[model samples]
Target: MLSHVEVTARVALTSVAHFVWSNRLEYAHDCFVCRRVGRTVSLHPNAENGLCHSSERRLEWQDDIDVAGAHPAPIRVTGFDTAGDETSQRLRCRLAFWWSPFFDLKRPDERASELSEKRWVRLHYRVGCHVCRDAGHDDWFGPQNSVQSNQVWPVTSSCQRCDTELVTVAGPPEINLVG
Candidate 1:
């Protein structure tokens, strides 16, 4: 039999792997964006200015968890660019997990019934521009323009309304169990 630690590790690892793999496409897509912009980006919890964009050209998934009885889990991932800062940027992705027996999870007795309590996971991506801005100007809009001056600001960083820090994860939950 597997020790509790082993079982837990397996489960956690599985969870993480599943999380990473299931979201690999997303990660890759984000990485592609960062690469195109020539900057490093992270796709995990606690990332700085990490959130994704919505169809409406607005930042998506910026809410925090507040389930009644269960807790939340958050992870941060980061990525970087290789072409140097001129056209480079840094990206951060944050994922939050929320649990609620009533809505998110099923009762203990339903474990094997395909209705077991489950945690709801929410993902957010934040891309920050560490280089020069306002590259849309004619002088900054050329193939040979300075890499730093020729970069376009990421839509993920600009607030739709206020145009500020587009997204921010809620404070870490007070209760979290890793077993």
Candidate 2:
């Protein structure tokens, strides 16, 4: 049998290969309601948030005119753009699926020093509780279901909003590039 160091080195080297090897992951945050891109400002006095209704008026902007006021700050929607096509999408989906906290094993870096380690890993999952699941998202694929989140090894967590324990489990072995 290999010594502990030999085993650790092997695991570390292998886990690195499991990472999605892409240079082109781009992130975006826009208003989910209006699809208004962020980093921009309204050009005119519009319903506290709607586009200016100041078109050369057959009617006119009333002093007390009512319109659907958008959120004081637009509700930020998020998405990413992959540089490559189908292959990249597949790779991303694979990596995302394994990002869950493992139930039985310590994170690879703790067991294998050869692996480069970070203080935290970015993950996007939700505490499956009605209180935490935004205002509306109940079942699956809700905007709040996968908010910006993270985890560390020896994974332990409580709902950020609810203080309930989150159950996490390891799935099939992470995909590795051994060949």
Candidate 3:
């Protein structure tokens, strides 16, 4: 039999794997920003190739992002917005869930009908700013930009209201459950 610690560790590991696998495809796109200048940038899928959206002078930006820190962070789905159609809304929900840091790989296919019926996709994670962690500050941790595809913005100017690091989990109607 598994001890409590063992069980917890197993669960945590499973959760991490699920999150990584589900969102791996999404991150495959070059989605990153310059931590120093707050300028939007992209990292090549192949890091060894040393390719980036900016000039070669900015190559150091890739090294500064700390991709490892982007993983194993707690996440939650917070909310949802729809322009009109249910199908479109569902697609958006799926996309959001795919990018979620707390993504659960087990739930979706099993409950496809239910989710489609409700016109909602479960947002399983929250996004935290790694730059804040590197700065030795915990006050601003939430998404600096609105939840858009492959976009990163400056957390300092955007998250000035909250002194504690702000983690924006999927909230309200978007995420069916509260964290």
Candidate 4:
């Protein structure tokens, strides 16, 4: 078994979501209901094809977006294409800071204050599952990538079924390298 490897990197919070999607890195998040690993369980009761697209396993994005102050930025989602295999394509969505809403605490005033504040946030790509206490399987986590990969994630979430608060892995400190 490969020992747990922790690599750190500095990334602007705004760009972290794009970075993860572009790199095709594997990330493991627990089921909001049973605490089962994202890759190992399906939350949808109607799901029959073994394809899970819910937030329990994926970070879905809205239809329209504003990037760099550009209104209605045409965001595109490009999935992993297996050469000559159209049916095998893997769809991964890029998440942005706006995906997680943050209120402007500084300005309680209604008219003058900005509605939300967007800032770079620190996140951790858990190398393994804390509940299972196993690190033997690489697929249990997100895709493995080079050290330059940028990684960021939603700060808080809840299991849709059980409503249990989901917790992500803690981030690396004082390290400018990303894994």
Candidate 5:
């Protein structure tokens, strides 16, 4: 059984991931902080946070908009341009299936084996990038190219437009457990 905190974290993380993936806000969007800064927002999926280049703002999973808003802020993985680490995290088995030999079942052996393999492992990763939304540059990062699950955030990145070094820290997200 998972502790209350762990369970809440998992639920929040899943909900945020679902929201981000569904909205496709992992790319060029207005930064949650300085709404004036319009550029590529880096989303660290595994870390459950991201950083915006416009202001070098770090976004967390728990960051929320007001109740009157129709949607929550966008979630993204930072530095999706570069490769990140992948790790396995185990998930609890919630269902129990009893295989009865006498029952007429199609591929009973396969069904039993499938149910028996309830212990699951999920891959987590992390990445980082500078939020350079220069109108001329096309270096945009998104979920498919950038998101990492269960890994540390990148330490350094350069603004694609200004070439200035940006220090990035994988800030602890409200939701710690991904799987």
Candidate 6:
């Protein structure tokens, strides 16, 4: 059997509850949960999304946001045709970030009065329950995307609902190059 190819689903702009910055002038993006800096990237680069957005496995609605300083920015989310197909219509402002109330530590590079285990780093993870998905068919019946935090988690996990083993796939495609 042949599987349909759709790489666009993996292309996305990720926004964590908080950003990870480098100790030096360089900026970075990492798996905040593990404090693993895969590589350092620029804050802004002269680039464009060359991918054809004319049509793809994406929402028809797009959000246009304008922010200046701490001001409440005026935002707009609309579709070319609101009354169009439901599958093609979605909002970009999905509430997918969670902040830990116990977030209480400065960046690791920052000097502290004294070294102590009380230090903490906010965590984040992209989780899914393949078993709960019921052989990759159910959507609403499974844990889709989880935004959570804790000191640490096991490298491998189990389906909260079905107890199926879950493991993080090896790198490369799992890391969003466009992100």
Best candidate (score: TM-score)? 6
Compute the lDDT for candidate 5. Answer: 0.27
- Candidate 2's error at 59, in angstroms? 58
Best by lDDT: 5
**Per-model TM against the reference:** 0.19, 0.22, 0.18, 0.18, 0.20, 0.23
**Model 2 TM-score, all chains together:** 0.22
Task: State the TM-score for model 1.
Answer: 0.19
lDDT of 6: 0.22
Per-residue lDDT of candidate 2, residues 38-93 (tens digit): 21112111222322222121121222322344233321112222233321112121
RMSD of each: 17.7, 21.7, 19.4, 18.0, 18.5, 18.5
Preferred candidate (lDDT higher): 1 or 2: 2
Off by over 4 Å in 4: 1-65, 68-156, 171-179
User: Model 3, residue 156: displacement in angstroms?
Assistant: 16
> Tens-digit lDDT track for model 1 on 1-179?
11010000000111101111112112111112111111112233234332332221211221321223221112123322112132222222232222222211222233221111121222222232211124232322112101111123321223222233322222221112223
Tell me the whole-model lDDT of each prediction, alpha carbons only.
Answer: 0.21, 0.23, 0.23, 0.23, 0.27, 0.22
Worst 10 residues of 3 by lDDT: 2-11
lDDT of 1: 0.21
In model 5, the worst 10-residue window by lDDT is 3-12
lDDT of 5 by residue, 62-89 (tens): 1232223223233433222211222211
Clashing pairs in 6: 60-88
Point out the worst 10-residue segment of candidate 4 by lDDT.
112-121
Better of 2 and 3 by TM-score: 2
* Ten-residue region with minimum lDDT total, candidate 1: 2-11
Q: Which residue pairs come into collision in candidate 2?
A: none
Supply candidate 3's per-residue lDDT for 98.
17
